[model samples]
Target: MTAVKVIKVVGTSEESWEAAAKEAVERASQSVEGVHGVEIDHWTAEIEDDEIVEYRATTEIAFPVQD
Candidate 1:
């Protein structure tokens, strides 16, 4: 039998939410092996002075469990 794990990660980008989500997955992949997929759990942004400052994304990254 095989086991899978899901972890939540948050990443930020000034460009867009997509970039932020991608960043989170990429960063998580660095330490996590056998990455299967990513699911966008939630998303939010930060604004300052009526201007978008940063885009933040929350994602659930799925990967095979390490033994």
Candidate 2:
């Protein structure tokens, strides 16, 4: 049998929401191994002076557990 665990994380970027989502996984993978999949939970943005300044993404990362 295999064991899997999930973690919630947030990533922000000045580019796009897709990039933010990808960044979340990329940053998480730096500390987490055996990453299998990612689930995008939510998306939001920050606006400043009638312009969108930042993009944010919330994601859940799934990875395998080693015994």
Candidate 3:
């Protein structure tokens, strides 16, 4: 039998939504092993001086269960 695990993580970047998503995956991979997939749940941004300052991404990271 095969098993998997998923966890939610939030990443932020001043660049773009894609960068934010990439940050989430990259940062998560640092601590979580066997990281294989990622799904973006939602996107948000911060405004400053009536302009977009930061991009945020909520993602679900998936990896195989370990025993």
For residues 1-67, what per-residue lDDT tens digits would candidate 2 score against the true structure?
Answer: 8899999999999999999999999999999998989999999999999998999999999999978
TM-score of each: 0.94, 0.94, 0.95
Ranking of models by lDDT: 3, 2, 1
Give me the runs in candidate 2 sitting further than 4 Å from their true place.
Answer: none
User: For each candidate, what is the lDDT?
Assistant: 0.94, 0.95, 0.96
Task: Choose the strongest candidate by TM-score.
Answer: 3
lDDT minimum window of 10 residues, candidate 3? 1-10
lDDT value for model 3? 0.96
Worst lDDT window (10 residues) for model 1?
A: 29-38
For candidate 1, lDDT tens digit of each residue in 1-67? 9899999999899999999999999999899999889999998999999998999999999999889
TM-score (C-alpha) between model 1 and the true structure = 0.94
